[model samples]
Target: MNIKSLLLGSAAALAVVSGAQAADAIVAAEPEPVEYVRVCDAYGTGYFYIPGTETCLKIEGYIRFQVDVGPDESGPSSWDAFTRGQVQFTAKSDTEYGPLTGVIVLQANADNATFQDTILDSAYLDIAGFRAGLFYSWWDDGLSGETDDIGSPVTLHNSIRYQYESGDFYAGISVDELEDSPFYNGETPNNVGVAVGLGGKAGAFSYQVTAGYDTDNEAGAVRAMGTVAVGPGTFGLAAVWASDPGAYYNAAEWAIAAEYAIQATDKLKITPGAQWYGNYGVVNGATDADFGSDDAWKVGLTVDYQITDNFYAKATVNYLDGDDIDDVTTGYFRLQRAF
Candidate 1:
């Protein structure tokens, strides 16, 4: 044990193996600061940002296929085919009291076999502009064509609404629950509907007016519409009035409509429509108090095409004539895919 005690135990075993290799090269955690998924553009495009929660979300959907040919509804020039699917989910945030929203939609119909279960095409809640539960009301906001049949076959339900907007003006009101309308055949009771709306837009025009009331057959309805921006597209007009047979328009005791939407390029579109009724009184499925004398008329043509970025295709054709109704010619053909 001479040479200075073996060089002082080999310099203390190389300083204890260099302090265990600098404590095994240090780093035990750092991968946990990731949060990724963010793009919420404040609720405009596809949305996102739900990961740790500033709420924002969006999901969209569509799937459809259709074919139909008519003659007073599949009894004279019959043809049919159908498929459908839909989905939606939206959420937003921005507290204080203005931007907060929620929505849900689900739909399915593949006729007779599978996919017949899901159905709740809307579930709502909106804020600031107030809203609640189910949806679709305002007499279904008609007038874009497919040969106008002004509305009131029960456009969804359960509601409570309110709205207001400035600048371009706006207004709304609702309080529905039409005891399962479709013109309620269980004879009266289970009613209470009311809706009102007013709209606006200027420069290139736009307008809307609506009203409805069906306090258990105390009857009521009204509608109005307008549009302009002539030349390459847009031109419209609409009117409706009712006072009987309850629940919104009841298929006319007064009606009028017209349209012209032509884009024809950048992926096609075309529309041409007309409608006139005046004491029409629809009766397709029983339960009625009718409206007035009887008279009807329609004419239509519609087309749309855009085969990318969300996909689409549509077709329409119509011709109807009436007075206790019967003359017919109808149409449909469609395809869709969206996201």
Candidate 2:
């Protein structure tokens, strides 16, 4: 071949090679695929599947502002304002036995001037109707309004429980550690309590009976409650009897409460309730002289208004009267937003 032809051939080959190299450099690699969060409807609404796991997670919370006007420790009566925020995390997974769930709730409160301490309100696990960990006492379950107090003091406890539910019938039993319970008086004994509850619904009527025994005091209390639908509202009745006063159950010997929740509108509810206490204020086997009252009664009205899907307001006014004590009136207003 001629030298000029050879040189032209070499240049053409070099240009071809360089062009191929440039084309290869300009070509980009494919991007990695993204994993998006998937909605989990297996449990309920507002739940999403946890990434890279079969578990489902749900986060919910509420912010509340409250104004209270009532008796205080140092003052006869005072008005106080407080704000509270709460967050709850829930995780659930299906298992061979049943659905396993874990919940954690954190709460913080602040007054108008000072910030209160944060608290872990609840931490618990449930599997196959079996539950354990720190939770509210089952005895505190009652009607929707605050007026349906059957004298059972509401508190939290570390407990283990098993519940069986079928259709409209349910039963549960629990063993609680009551060492740090507020119901204890001076010296506590066994510091343990047992609780059992049974309930069923038939047609428009539902009834529940619960009993709690304090091993330390060798005393127990029994509570029976029932509700029936009437027209556009519901009527509820509850009765409680305790062997010992203020011993993990009723604060008095016996108490009865009645409440009627009236649906004023689609977004408004009004509940009027009344409670009667026999041998009121008797605690730790104290006589009437200690409390200066043998009987007491309370009447209250609660109003709830739902402003939106996740916003609501509540107001409650209560009047308490005793045989030998001054009549007192208390009330509170609360605004809340939930998510």
Candidate 3:
């Protein structure tokens, strides 16, 4: 063969080999597919299914800015401002027993440039009709307005409860660890309490009855409340009776409250409420001399305005009077946004 022919043949072979290598490199392997989060409408809004899991998760909460005027039993502050934020997490799944759910809430408050400690507002689990956890006491049933204090103290404690529900009828019973409860009076031998509640609604009328028994003091309190729709508003009436006064009802032997919530407009609500306390000033089985007054009453008005879908503003003014105590007035304004 001639020298030129030999060189041409060698170059052609080299080109063929390089072309094959380039073709192999251009052919890439297929990639794995990706999974995305899916929305879960089974429970409610703002819920989504966890990737690759049947469990559904939801997160919700609110932020509140409040301004208060007047003096409380705590101290004499002409005005005070505070901001509070809360977040809640919920997880739900279906099980053989029924729908199982868990919830956790965290809260923080800041007042006058001082930040308070964070709080676990609520943590609980529910399956079927059984629940257990740290939560508010069952005695918390009352009207919407803050002035309607049905003599039930607001506090949280560890508890286990079983509840039954059918349509608008429901009943529940709970046992609480009352050692750290706000109702615990000094040196109580017993540190447990039991509570039961029954509630139902028929048409535009609804009623609820709740009772709590303190094992240590061998005393209890009973509260009954009813509401009915009348004209452009709803009227509510509630009464409470306690055997140990402040230990259970956070009031005297007996107390009564009435409120009327008027839907003045689509975005505005006005509620006027009144409460009367009889045989006032008994706390933890002991009667204080300052509570010498046998009767005390309070009248208050609340106005709530919905600024937007998730924003609201509320204002409340209250007047308090008693047989021996000086007349006092208090009020607060609050703005809140929720998700």
Candidate 4:
């Protein structure tokens, strides 16, 4: 009888201890999985998908240092040396209609003794070949060398543009917003510019012709350029005609420019170019007496060298002569690193 009673007491104590241990035990829940960044090659290199989104983003930019020297020592004809850095972000994704893309570019610069404010250089959206926002217009396209001034008075503008491409044939049109002049009178109305271009390539030859009109000034400009591959070089010809002094092509009433860029070596190119202008000093208008109707001409040599995969150096020297102004020498040396 005593042995039976002792066994019952030990069993009750063990059961109580087991219940206590069960109550004190802690349970841990599993953790959520992590999402990783993925490479997106559908667009191009250096693009990756956002951790939780379908969109892909690419970041790229370039840093450039340039020294510009001109004849005069003071005023507008003085020299300018500057360092500039730019960063660009491009986001892209596929949609029902087509590929949707957005781009933003920021730039900072130090010119001469002044540190300029950082600015938004370009921001635009493109979808199905339609583009909008602030960007370089189609008129900014020029020859391969820097010896030619072949763009609007203000090359950058808030614009809406559409482009279409088929094989080697392409075309584009733009409506650009023009900024008010510093001499704006309260009665001066707002202004806008319109431009259109058509281009094509055939074997060793390619050409583009573009026209622009300034609504405020009631003036228009037309430009045509062509390039052909010849032996180890490319020969380019460009001509521009303007009805009067306007925003798009005021460098001259009419101008003719030409250049032959020779690939002297795998890493070096040499280009000698020339330009002749009719009524070059008529930049402002018939009202601005400072710029006369004198003719001008320029000849220049440009050199480009690739130092490394992402580094390049360029230099150009030009001599200018006009009926009203004395002969002058001007050029610039630039180094750029791009990624």
lDDT of each: 0.82, 0.84, 0.84, 0.85
lDDT by residue (1-339, candidate 2, tens digit) is: 599999999999999999888784655888989789999999989999888999999999999999998888225647888899999999999999889999999999988556587999999999999999989876868887878667456468888999999999999999988766444445453388899989999999999999888776566889999999998899999999887754466556788999999998999999999998887775444322122248989999999999999999999999999886789888899999999
Model 4, 228-268: lDDT tens digits are 99989999999998876667777778899999999999999
Q: Compare the candidates by TM-score and give the number of the best one.
A: 3
- In model 1, what is the error at residue 227, expressed in angstroms? 32
* Candidate 3 global Cα RMSD: 2.9
lDDT of 3 by residue, 136-188 (tens): 86686688787877745645778899999999999999988776544334444
Q: Provide TM-scores for the models.
A: 0.34, 0.88, 0.90, 0.88
Runs in model 3 lying further than 4 Å from the true structure: 1-32, 72-76, 183-185, 188-190, 283-293
Off by over 4 Å in 2: 1-29, 73-77, 183-185, 283-293
Question: If ranked by TM-score, best first, what sequence of candidates would result?
Answer: 3, 2, 4, 1
How far off is residue 202 in model 4, in Å?
A: 1.3
Where does the lowest 10-residue lDDT sum fall in candidate 4? 180-189
Provide the lowest-lDDT 10-residue window in model 1.
182-191
Q: Model 3: which residue pairs collide?
A: none
Between candidates 1 and 4, which one is better according to lDDT?
4
